[model samples]
Each structure stands twice: as C-alpha cells, then as structure tokens.
Target: MYSEEQKMYFSKNLLDWYQTHKRDLPWRRSKNPYYIWISEVMLQQTRVDTVIPYFHRFIDQFPTVEALATAPEENVLKAWEGLGYYSRARNLQSAVREVHERYDGVVPASKEDISALKGVGPYTSGAILSIAYNKPEPAVDGNVMRVLSRYFLIEEDIMKPSTRTIMEKLARELILDGTASDFNQALMELGAMVCTPRSPHCLTCPVMAHCSAREAGMEEALPIKKKAKPPRPELRAVALIEGTGEHAGKWLIRQRPQEGLLARMWELPHVEWATTAWQSDEDNQEALRAALAEQEQIGIQPEDWFMDTEHIFSHIVWKMKVYRAKLGDANRPSTGEEWIPFHYRWVGPEDLQNYAFPNVFVRIMREWQEGNEA
Candidate 1:
C-alpha cells in the first residue's frame, strides 16, 4: 500500500506530467457529467480512436439527456450500429430516461446516485464523480490496475477480489492534494500513453523512480490475470432470398427474437446446416427446396430459384447460400412473416441509411451494392 506522503508525491508528479503531455481528446475539454458518462460507457472494451467518432456522432444526435430519452430506440441503435455490444446502447437509453425522469434531466452528482443508474458500475460512477463533480474518488479500471500494481509491486492476480481491495485503498491514499479530477485523469493518461499494457515506456514515466516493479525488473509481469475461457462455436446457414421484379429491388428482412446474441436486431432468414449429401446440381436444388419448405414453410418448385454467397463470424461460422426468385402468385407472406410489398416503394439502398444493421448484413449490402454499381 502507498503511504500518504508517497501518494501525494506520486499524484503531484503525475498531474504535472499530464498537464504537459495529456492528449487533446474531446471529452477532456468539458467537465459535463453527461459527456463524461457517454465517453466512459463507449470506452468500455473499445479503443480510444474507435470511440472518438462514435462519441461525436452520439452527442450531436442527442445533445442532452432529454434528447436521448425522447429519441426512438431504433434511432439510438442505428447511431450505435458499428460499435458492437448492443446491450450498451439499450442500457444507455434506459440510463438517459432515468436521468430525465428522476433527476429532472440532470446527471446525478453523488457517487451513489450515479452508480444507481443502469449499466453505471463502480468504475463509471467513480469517473463521473471525480472528473465531473471533482469528488475525491478512485476510478480503478484496468489501466489504473496496471499502473498501481507496477508502482507498488503487487503480486496478486488482478482478477482476485483481494487485489481490488488493496488497489482501491492505495488509490485513495495517493490522491494528490484533493485534486481528484486532475489526479484521476493524470493516472489514466499515464497508463494509456506511458505505462501501457505491453512494452511500457518506463523511461518516460513520471514516477519510474518510485515504481517497485520497475526496480525489481518485473514491470511487465505485475498485475497477473487469470486465463480466459475458450470461445463457444456455432454454425448457421443464412439464405439471401430475393423477391420478383419491382419486388426484386428489395429482399426479405426479419427481426431476430428479443433475446440471446444480437438480440432484437435485424437479420436475413437463416437456419442451422444439417449434414446432407448432394451428388449433382439437381440434388443441390432439391436440398435447397426441401430446407426452405421446412424452415420458412414456403413450398416452392425447385425450378424457380438461383443460388449466389457465404459469410462467417467469430465463434459462429456461417455457410450462407443465396437464392433469387420472383414472388409468383403462390409466393406470399405466410403466418408470422411480413412481406415488404414491391409497390410499397422498396426500402431503397439509400433509405437503409437510417436502420441499424448488423455488420454481416452491412458487409453483404456493401458487396451487393458495389456489384450493381460496377
């Protein structure tokens, strides 16, 4: 643990360094709690560079908590499209609504109140209170953990509860002259720029002389973490089923069930691939016909379809095959399915701009559109 004097010394040195070297990030320019909250939430498990554009776009779309609260969920999701982990978008909406309704459109000032908001955990709460409100609280994230472990030569696995307890105590002890806001930002900056995860620039670190891990030649090894679990494997067979003329301009799009991976998102019609043998083109067509009948319950003759692509995802590889067919007199929406009629002004490629599409669909659309343009 860091002594009171040592903490003060470290904070002062780090803060001085930060004032000179801190990155000119947009979030750092303002002390608004709402802005800080959005940046914190977006930065979770995402790179700083990646979060920059998203932050600007989100803030422009919803300048205030009330704006975010009133915005449709679909618009919010659309704005957050490329950024994965859709739950964050949903939780952000919930948090905005709560802030508007309960807090009179003001972000909560107290740590407890901020922490009570949806998806606002201890780290986020700490960041808001310290950076926005100037409260003397520690925002102990992975960056801070690395800096602390190396500074104090801590050996416990960072994943362990005991390590967190010790690190939090040390952070509190080291806050400089109650400049919690600057001190917190300074430490975070150091971790990001100097005391990085791999090959940290120790020679340039402000507190290198005091870092025990550096002195002991174990700077790279401190803050040990537990091994990660193996990724789950899954297989899916997606169909790029197309419709007949003017209808041919659009394709069938379906909303996924409101639970599990990619919940409440739109996707192409797909099914699990069953092991089967096809000896010829006739056999392949027959297999496609039977699978579509069983899954989509659209009984169709094999003669009316053309096959076309395949796509894949991490942990879930897809063997996608496209089939083009015109909506014959027999082809219509069965129970539980919606047919975007051809005459209803097809959702033109440009109109798709406002909808939140999964990355896979986005890629497919890009390739398809490019092909047509070419």
Candidate 2:
C-alpha cells in the first residue's frame, strides 16, 4: 500500500507531464461521448497508429449514432474489412442502435446505463463516462494495469480477475477531484511511451522517483502476466477457382455462413482437413475436389499449388495450402454459363470492393493481382 502523499505526488506529476506531452489524438479533440465510444472500441487489441486512419474514415462515414445505427451492416463490415476482430464492429453497431433509439442518440452518462449497452464493458463504460462526461471513473485497461503494477510494485498476475479488482480499486482512488479524463489518459500514455513492457524508460518517467518497482529494480518484470495457451493448428486446402470464356479474369468467392467464426465474410473456397490425416498436395487436391463437389456442388480441376499461408485466431491456426484451378466440365451449362450456388459469386478485381472479405482472402487476392501485374 502506498502512502497518500506518495499517490498525490505521482498523480500531480503525471498529470502535469501529460498536459504537455500527450499525443494530439483525434478522439481527444472533443468530449462527444459517441466519438469517444467509437474510438474506445476501435482501440481495443489495436495500436494507436493503426486505429488513427480507421477512426477518421469511420467517423467520416458514420458521423453520428443515428448514422451508424441506420447504415446497412454490410457497409459497416466493409469499412471494417482489414481491421479484423470484426465482431467489435457488429457489436458496436448493435449497441449504437440501442443508444439511438433509447437515449435519443446521446450516450448514457451513468455507469449502469452505459454498461447495459452491448460490447460496452466496464473499461469502455468508464472511458465514456469519464472522458466525455468528466465523471471520475477509472478506465483501467492493460496499459493502466502495467503502470499501476509497476508504480505500486504489485506482483500479482494481472490475468486474474481478483487482481483486476484490486487494481480497479487502487485506480479509482488515484483519480483526483476532477481529473479523471486526463488522469486516466496520463496513466495510459506513461505506460505506452515511457514505462513500456520491455526496457522501460525509467529515466524519463514522470513518476519514476517514487515508483516501487523502479526502487526494487524490477520495473520490467513486475506485471506478472501468465501466458495464454497456444492456438491449435488445423490444415486447410484452398481452391483459387478461376473463371473461363466470358467469365475470364474473375475468381469464385463465397460468403461464410451467417454465424460462427469470420461470420458472413467472403473468402476463397476452402475445406478443412484433420491435422492427423493431412496428406500430400495431390491427395489434398483430390480431397478438396471431392469435398467441394459433395458439399457445395462445385467441381474444380486443380492445376497446381499456388501458395501456402496461415491465419491465427485466439484458439485456432489455419495453415492453408492454396491451389490454382479451373471449373470442372460438369459445372458448365450448355448455354456457355457456369452454374454456381446462389451463395457464391464470380468476382472480378473491380467488384472486390463491393463485398467484405476476410484479411486472409484480401491478401490472397492482392498477391494474385501483383502476380498478374508482374
């Protein structure tokens, strides 16, 4: 436990440092709760540099709660195509729609009311209330946790919920009379810019003089976070099915089922294989053909292996082998047209922007385009 005077010195010095040293972030320019809400959601599991342009584009497109609420979900997904963790966009829209209808487009000021919104967790609610409404709620995220764990020399695992509760209590106490907005942001800035995860810049930290971890020479290792389980690997075979004749210069793409992982995003036709049963490329091609034909009524003659790529999710890693192919003769109708399922579309390069595709598929298409240009 830190002395009250020590906490006061830390808070005052940190706030003073932040007043002049904080980055000129767009979200900080206004106290608009809606904008703060969007920025908070986008910043989750994302870097500040990456979120900047996305924030500008998103705000320009859906400038208000009503705009985001009424806009088609496809447009939202398309705007969020490359950002990944797309469920954030979906949940944000859902919650915004609720705010538009229930709160007349105004973000809720009370913690309970804001917390009730979908995707608005304790941190988000705290951010919205404090930053936008000047309420003294502690917005404790991973960055804040790192700062607190070091400044106070806390050695508990931050991954545990009980540890988080303690941190939250300490953080709430640190908030001065009316400095919640800048105080929380200061803690975050200190953690990000000075007290980094590795080789913390202790020489430049505003609160380094009294930081308990610095005093003990354990600044870099105080925040004890347990490692998460590694993602399980799964083998997948992807078919880059090219069109023929009048449909030349196009590739077949399909929409994912309306639910589950990467829900409703577009991707190249692919089939999964058990890791233990994985076989050679030729056998994999045969499996891909049989699987597509039996499952989706699509037939293809794989010409050769094109590339190998991998996408890692929280729990799974898809190690994909891509093969170039042409539609099999059976799928060709006598009218010189191809009969694809309704869910599938033959998209040319020009039509790619009209649909939302997962980042992996976007990478594949970009590679194919670059290869053609080369």
Candidate 3:
C-alpha cells in the first residue's frame, strides 16, 4: 500500500518528467475530444509510430464527427485498411454515428454518456475524458499497468479482471490535483520510455527512487502476465483470378459478408481447405476449382501455384495458398461475356485505392504489382 506522501511523490515527479520528455505526437496538439478519441482507439493493440500517419490521414478525410458519421463505410474502412482489427473501424463509425445522432455532433464529456457509446471501453473512455476534458478518470491500460506494477512492486496477474479494477482504484488516487491528463499520460509514458516490459531502464525512470520493484531488484518480473494460447491454424486456398477481354487489366476481388470475420472488407476469393491432404498439385488445383464453382458459382481455370502466405489473428491463423488463375471459359456465356457475380468485381491496379482490404490481401496485391513491374 502506497502512503499518501509516497503517492504524491510519484504523481508529482511523473508529471514533471512528462512535461519535459513527452513526445510531440500530433494528437497531443489539440484538446478536441474527437481527435483524442480516434487516437486512443487507434493506439489499442497498435504502436504510436504506426498510428501517426493513419491518424493524420483519418483526420484529414473525416475532419469532423459529422464527416465520419456521413462517410461511406467502405471509405472509412479504406482509411483504416492497414490498421488491422476491422471491428475497430466498424465500431468507431458506429460510435461516431451515434455521437452525431444522439449527442448532436458533440463528444460526451461525462463517463456515463461516453461509456454508453459503442466500442468506447473503459480505458478509451477514460483517455478521452482526461486528455480532452481534463476529467480525473483513470486510464489503466497495459502501459499504466506495467508502470504501476513495477513502481508499486505489484505482482498481480494483470490478465485477471480483478487486478485491473484494483489498478484503476490505485491509479485514481495517484492523480495530482488538476493534473489528471498529464498524470495519466506520464504514467503510460514512463512505462513506454523507461519501465519497459524487459530489462527496463530503472536508472532513467522518474519514480525509480521509490519504485518498489527497482528497490527489490524485481523490476523485470513484477508485472506477472500469463501467456496466451497460440492461434489455431486454418488452411485456406485463395484464387488470384485475373480478368480477360474487356476486363483484361483487372483482377477479381470480392467483398466479405456484412457480418463476421473481416466483415464488409474487400479480399480475394478464398475457401478453407476441408483437409490438407491433397496428394499432388493436380489434386489441389482440382479441389480449388471445385470449391469455387460449388460455393461461389464462379468458374476458374487454375494456371499454376502462385504463393503461400500466412496471416495471424488473435485466435485464428490462416495459412493461405494462392493460385494464379484466369476466368474459365466455361463461365463465359455464348453471348461472349463473363457472368460476374453481384458481390465480385474486376479491380485494376489503379482502382485498388477505392476499397479497403485486410493486410493479407494488400500484401497479395503488392506482390502482384511487383511482378507486373518486373
């Protein structure tokens, strides 16, 4: 248990350190609740450096809550393309739409109202409230957890919900009067810049003199977290269907179903392999053909194997094998045209920007483009 004096010391020193050393991130330049909200959402499961450009581009495109609310879902998804976790984009738009409709284009300042917004979890709500509105809310994210664990020498398993609740209480107590915004940012900044997950720079830490973990030489092991289970692997066969005739310059892509995994994002046509037991390339090719024909009613003539790529999500790993193929003549009618499905489209290289794609599909498109240039 930290004494009130000790807590004050930690809070004071951390804010002083942050004032001098905080990074000049673009999001920090404004007190606009909307920008702060977007930055917080992007920072989840993503790094600061990576979110910078995305932040700039996103804000530029949808400068106001109303713009984001009115923008096409595809455009929003396109803006968030490389930033994985498609649900964040969807939920953000949903929340933005709600803010537009319910809040009159204003970001709610109170915890009660902000928390009710879809996808605005406790941490994010806290971040927006404190950073934008200067509310004394605790933003107890992973960085804050790491800093708190080391400073207080707390050994709680951070994965547990109970531990987070405790941390939140402790965090709230540590906020100096009228410094909630800087104090919370300082806590996370210390964890990010000095009290890192491994071999932390205890010597450079602002709260090092009072850090229980540093004094006890347990800084490296203080924040005890259990390992997560490995992603389950699924074998997927993807068809890189090229176009011919009037659609000669384009490649085929389809929009995902409006619900479930990577919902509404553009991706190559693919089917999961029922079994990874193909005896030969011929068997694989034939299986790919049959699956597409039966499932999508789109016929393809598999020319040759293209490449194999792997994408890992939190729970699933897709081990995909891509096949180079052209629209099979069987799918062309005697009317001398290809029967294009409503959901599928022939997109050329220049047309790639109009749709949002998961990173895996983006990689495939980049690879194809490279081959074209070569």
Clashes of each: 1, 0, 0
Model 2 TM-score on a 0 to 1 scale: 0.98
C-alpha TM-score for every candidate = 0.85, 0.98, 0.98
Candidate 3: list runs displaced more than 4 Å: 276-279
For candidate 2, give the lDDT.
0.91
1 against 2, candidate with superior lDDT:
2
The lDDT of each candidate is 0.76, 0.91, 0.90
Model 2 regions more than 4 Å off: 333-336
For model 1, how does the per-residue alpha-carbon lDDT over 176-260 read when each residue is reduced to its tens digit? 6568899888888898999999999999999988888999999988778896554444344444455555555565566666778
lDDT of 2 by residue, 133-230 (tens): 88999898999999999999899999999999999999999999989999988888998899899998999888888999988989878799999999
- Per-residue lDDT tens digits for candidate 3, residues 128-175, read 999898899999999999988888888989999999999999999998
- Decreasing lDDT order of the candidates: 2, 3, 1
Please report the candidate that would top lDDT against the real structure.
2
RMSD (Å) of each candidate, 1 decimal: 4.3, 1.2, 1.1
Error of 1 at 100 (Å): 0.6
